[model samples]
Target: MERPIGVIDSGVGGLTVLHELKRQLPKEQFIYLGDTLRCPYGSKGEEEVIQYTWEMVNYLMKFDIKMLVIACNTATALVLEQLKQNLPIPVIGVIEPGARAAIKATQSNHVAIIGTENTIHSQAYEHALIRIKPNIDTTAVACPKFVPLIESGNFVLEEAKEIVEESLEFINHYPTIDTLILGCTHYPIIQSLIEEVVGPRVTVLSSAVETGFEVSTLLTFYNLYHANTEEIHEPAIFTTGKLHVFQRLKEDIFQLKNASLKHITLS
Candidate 1:
């Protein structure tokens, strides 16, 4: 199919998932929308998040997309089921895949999830993990500052390491939690920093990679997998904030070549 797959997030965090999607399914096209204008949806009210999430969905539906991936944990937690029930196309989220991966990787049954304030509050990962393995013990931490650091592209700085360490100090007491789920899409940008803070005992998991694999499985199940691998199409990137911000990250960090990025406004 020529139609692209739509991926949406509160900001550039979604690029982590899109990056993996590109590697896993190179033949398919992608339309990534980052709601950078009203980002850090971490602290927003549930009603506001749902409204913003729908705005992104409405915006992406403008394209001829075959599927929709809610790459933001906050959005997925708040509105994924609603989107799936209402949208015509298939809809997927990052929570389940990450929960699944953690369930398989953890030996101690105690799992740690670090995400935005809203995502942690929603207990989406906890629900998903417990649903799959009822006895799973989940400890969720709200890392409110992580998203802004990543959104500003300051993830590689020394201060970023300090922020990661400070935010993750709570995990130190819970040493039994051997598996950490990077619940926010943006968290993957600072994966190495997180790994350093958590040390070798805990295996950190990002939903980005697992989410990409989930997309692949859905594409095949829906019979939407592209037939022509030779004809590759550059993913379209859009931001409801600054085009330059998205452009720089797409170019320097994401290293996504030939991407056409534009500034857009959503009502």
Candidate 2:
């Protein structure tokens, strides 16, 4: 199957996942839709998040995607199961892969998760972790400020460091937590800053890498690998909001200079 994989995110944060996907499966094509206009789905109500996520999914479905990756933690937490049940394609979410990675990295059997308000409120990561290892000690914190900061493209500034440090101060209380899961895909955008704040004592894991591996596994299991490997495939990127930041990140950060970027409206 040469059909493209569909990836949806609240914003460019999902690019972190996309980056790994492209690296791991260089021949696969992707169509990414970011609901940047309503970028921070973290604080939104449950119904609103579902509606927004469906809009993005419907938009990407036009491309005849073979699989769907819900790259936004908030949307994944609220809507992943529903998508898996409803969509014809295989649906993958960040939470489970992240939980699995955290479990593998934690030597203390204690892990901390940092994501958006809705993701934390949903207790999605906790449930996922506990489901895998019933005895795992999990601490989750909602960093309501992070998505906006990364979406603003100021993630590299000095102020970003301060905000990351402040937002993660609660980790200090969990000394037994040997691993920290960057629960939100957006958190990986500012991962270095996060690691600096959390320090070397704790290992920070991004679901992006683990998510990439999952996608690869599913592609092999489903026999969905693209038939043509000789031709270079550039992902198609779409955003519902401003294009400047998305363009910069796509080129400068993710280094997808060949990817086509466009502005589109869902409603």
**What TM-scores do the predictions have?**
0.97, 0.98
Please, what is the whole-model Cα lDDT of each candidate in the order they appear? 0.91, 0.93
Q: Best by TM-score, which number?
A: 2
Write the residue-wise lDDT of candidate 2 on 1-267 in tens digits.
899999999999999999999999999999999999997999999999999999999999999999999999999999999999999999999999999999889999999989888999999999999999999998889999999999998888899888998999998898898999998888887888888899999999999999999999999999999999797699999999999998999899898999999999997
Which residue ranges in model 2 land beyond 4 Å of their true spot? none
Q: Candidate 1's residue-wise lDDT over 12-117, tens digit each? A: 9899899889988888999999999999999999999999999999998989788999999999999999999999999999999999999989999999999999
The clash count of every prediction, one per candidate, is 0, 0
What clash count does candidate 2 reach? 0
Whole-model lDDT, model 1? 0.91
Candidate 2 displacement at residue 181 in angstroms:
0.6
Error of 2 at 31 (Å): 0.4
Q: Which residue pairs collide in model 2, if any?
A: none
